[model samples]
Target: MAGFRWWFMAVLVVACWMKGVAGQARQQQAPAIWVFGDSLVESGNNNFLRSTARADFYPYGSDYYRGPTGRFSNARTFSDILGDWLGIAAPPPFSDPTAAGNRIMGGVNYASAAGGILDETGQHYGDRYSLNQQVVNFETTLSQLRTMMNPESLNQLLSNSIVVMVFGSNDYINNYLMPNIYATSRTYTPTAFANLLLNRYSRQIEALYSQGLRKFFLPGIGPLGCIPNQLATGQAPPGRCADSVNQMLGPFNEGLRGLVGQFNGGSHPGATFVYGNTYGVFGDILNNPGRYGFTVRDKACCGFGQGQITCVPLETPCFNHDQYVFWDAFHPTQAANGVLAQRAYSGTTNDCFPMNVQQLAQVRPM
Candidate 1:
């Protein structure tokens, strides 16, 4: 009976893998969502490594997508919602032992919790993939595509792929502020730091461009000062966003947008890069929760110490996720994610500068 059970399990795994392949066989304009970012889009992708940044436990996936699969959110992530809006499968995390190249033509999420644009920014997490490392992971996926499809087919797939890059918040919070330490805080002024990040960012996107990622949707950081964790950590006044920390994002965002403009008009000619107005969209939501059908915006839906501590597997989250903007100290509720995705997909110039995600997807990259 034991031997029979083991054999049955193997067969089931194989069956599931086959089913995944069939899904990828669907005829679609966009072949995949090759995502590479931070915790906002990760889905159990961190488990394959020995990283302390694992979230494959309970209460993490409370709102949807079955049990916790290492997503940094309590429910679906920004990538998940965006994938749904695009009518493509959310990229499987390359970290999944089962995510063989055969099952990932639709997309794969390589975002990791505690990850940052700079390799050393989120080192406090102990073992998270840096932005550079995530790009390396994409190379692994690219090699697989080379084997699975013809050269023309691979190029076609990649040219149409919507490569999403969401990062930057941790560089300030986790790196500069935490413990009031890290060399970055003392080494560079705000302008220098922003420039530093932008310089490295330009290189990173160029790496993606070399990999044939043409349609780029880069979401900037939201008001990190407004997050419950930031508030609690700083003991700021009730419901007030942090003024000092919030100020940092504007300069960084300017740098990011400028970088995108350069990529579109210069180095990567013909690439369609749309910068998601993440800060604006989320700021409006935070300011007018009632307008968005919410009652709570100050606290997280889950966690202890009134959200100072994030949710553990056994701790009970709030009964209403829709009412809260945050699910934990640093992440948003799936409800907020859905709203953000909708805006990013089709919202006008105010929501996505230059063009929206849908527009980027529909048009050809040079």
Candidate 2:
């Protein structure tokens, strides 16, 4: 009986060891999320910047657990919701003092409020990180990571990881459309401007690829004309969106989609580019708010008036924030963000071309 007992103990030890190995493998398979963009996904990077465009005050994050963590939404941003679905913790902002060491293993958010693809897009706001600058910051994070991890291991980590980019809206809303302030409108036609943006954007993506990054989730610009800020301009008839403003987005979005195809079909090995149809999904939500359980789709829930699109600091927002679509002049409420994230994560090809985020997350790097 002693011999039998010894054999049983040995078997149990082997079983436990195998289980631990399997668990570790599963943990390693989870992809890290690196987020970059404008106010739509800006976690708290803008707070660290001396910029006029910031949302570090009350009523901004009223629904967030850590209230007012500088997220532009009334609660979580689209990246936050998508992270929950992936079972990965939201990455700390790259500018955060504590976002160093192994903390970056999960990912890093370089998004900033009022940021844009063009360097001069949001200059009036003062000290915003353009897409070029964000990539530069990411390079800094990569340097820190290399110090802790070997080359092969770091390459594997970045190749299998996902990079989320949401840009272009600010280039239009704050740059091209603002003819008085920016020369872009006067310098280029709508089509010419789209081509210019894409040319610069292609270089940025190539820079990321050169750094060993692979998977990319690029969400296109939404319908800015439908937002309260544009609506307040009275460019459109009553209860209608600014058609002229929205029309300008078409060429840019189309060219962006083309960029995805170009990257995927190119010589770039193991590169998986997914274009998210944020415009279609957001426009659908705006047109069919009742289908999404939203009551107010025209105006913002927190701001004082159509002119003052953003919330007044310490102002009490509406109790039924979830019922409204817009949280302020330019940003969506948590409810809208949740719906958008869901569609992008698991929706059809019309929502996310080639594949959804879930499928993108499952793809193994070659």
**Pairs in steric clash, model 1:** 44-69, 91-107, 91-108, 91-109, 92-108
- The digit string of per-residue lDDT tens for model 2 on 1-366 reads 999999999999999997874454344335688998988999999889999888889989998999898799899999988877666778999889999987899999999888899999989989889999999999999999999999999998999888899999999999998999999999999999999998998899999999999999999989988998999988978888999999999999999999899889967888899999999999999999999999988888888635436887999888899999999988899999999988987899999998998889888878
Candidate 1: regions farther than 4 A off:
1-29
lDDT string, candidate 1, 1-366, tens digits: 999999999999999996774554343546678788877888876777667777777788876758788886777888887777676877678877778766788877888877887888777668888888989988998888788999988888889888889888878877866645588878888888888888888788889888888899998889888888888866467659887878877888988887777777777766789888899999999989998888888888877534565677767888887888888877888889978998998899999989998788888766
lDDT at position 67, candidate 1: 74
lDDT (0-100) at residue 290 of candidate 1?
90
Ten-residue region with minimum lDDT total, candidate 2: 21-30
